[model samples]
Target: MKLTESNALARVAAYCSKAERCEYDVRKKLLGWELTEEEQQRIIERLRKEKFLDERRFVQSFVKDKIRFNKWGKAKISFELRKKKIPADIINECLGELDESELDESLRKILETKNKSIKAQNDYERKTKLIRFALSRGFSMDQVLKTLTGIIGNTDEEYF
Candidate 1:
């Protein structure tokens, strides 16, 4: 059944309070609730003015959580945020806010994980697989290649 506008607002408020959310996600939810575009915009404006919806804040929190808890690199997190319609300036700002040391560590850990999963391959094949995996995870080619080289150069052990 189609809910009244007030009911939808209350429900969305309850949903958003549980976690940080992006405007794109909230828009999708409003559509799911069968709200008209005009009504959706009205509620969104109200939310924005009241500080319930802040794009910059959402991008910042989203990037932090994805990196910290999910171990995602900036490329991956940035892509997701872009898909949410966040501005490039804000996206760049949040990415710039990421610690370089933490980013390097996250890349190293992902490389290690990929290495473990593809241990039976030859050197050429191994590198190919690792690069592909990291690419799929949205890591940059240069970072993946450099780290892969470093890891392989330091290891004398054969693949499993």
Candidate 2:
């Protein structure tokens, strides 16, 4: 199947109109349209020239919505963008845009989710459970310990 330049531009225009998309995603779509490698590059370059292929914009939007709606951690979100063939430097730039407080809150929300599922009644057991959960959710031990200690240890009543 051959892809004409006009067809490719129209299709990309329609796609970008629906939502912000990264160049990698748009390139994949172009390939699906059976565009040749040169054709794909041409379309991508055109899109970039038109400001529809902004990488930083894609990164910020992706970071914002994933954290806000998907409740994803920096680790998970970084892993995902890396899978998309995004550059490591850009991924760091994107992750860096999130404030430390925002990261902690996202971690807190993850801890809450994990804690709610465990059957442990003792504070010790509960803390252990949270450590495992947050760690599995890709939080660092340091952050996990800090958040669990801060959120769960605010009370004096013995849970055991």
**Each prediction's Cα lDDT score?**
0.79, 0.80
User: Which 10 residues in a row give candidate 1 its minimum summed lDDT?
Assistant: 151-160
* Residue-pair clashes per candidate: 0, 0
TM-score versus the correct structure, for each prediction: 0.86, 0.85
**Model 1, 1-160: lDDT tens per residue?**
4777888887777767787777898899899889888888887887777777889988989887887788777788988888889999999987987787787777789888878888654777777787778777767877777777678763323421
RMSD of every candidate to native, in Å, equals 3.7, 3.7
Q: In model 1, which runs have C-alpha deviations exceeding 4 angstroms?
A: 154-160
How well does candidate 1 match the true structure, expressed as C-alpha RMSD?
3.7
Error of 2 at 14 (Å): 1.5
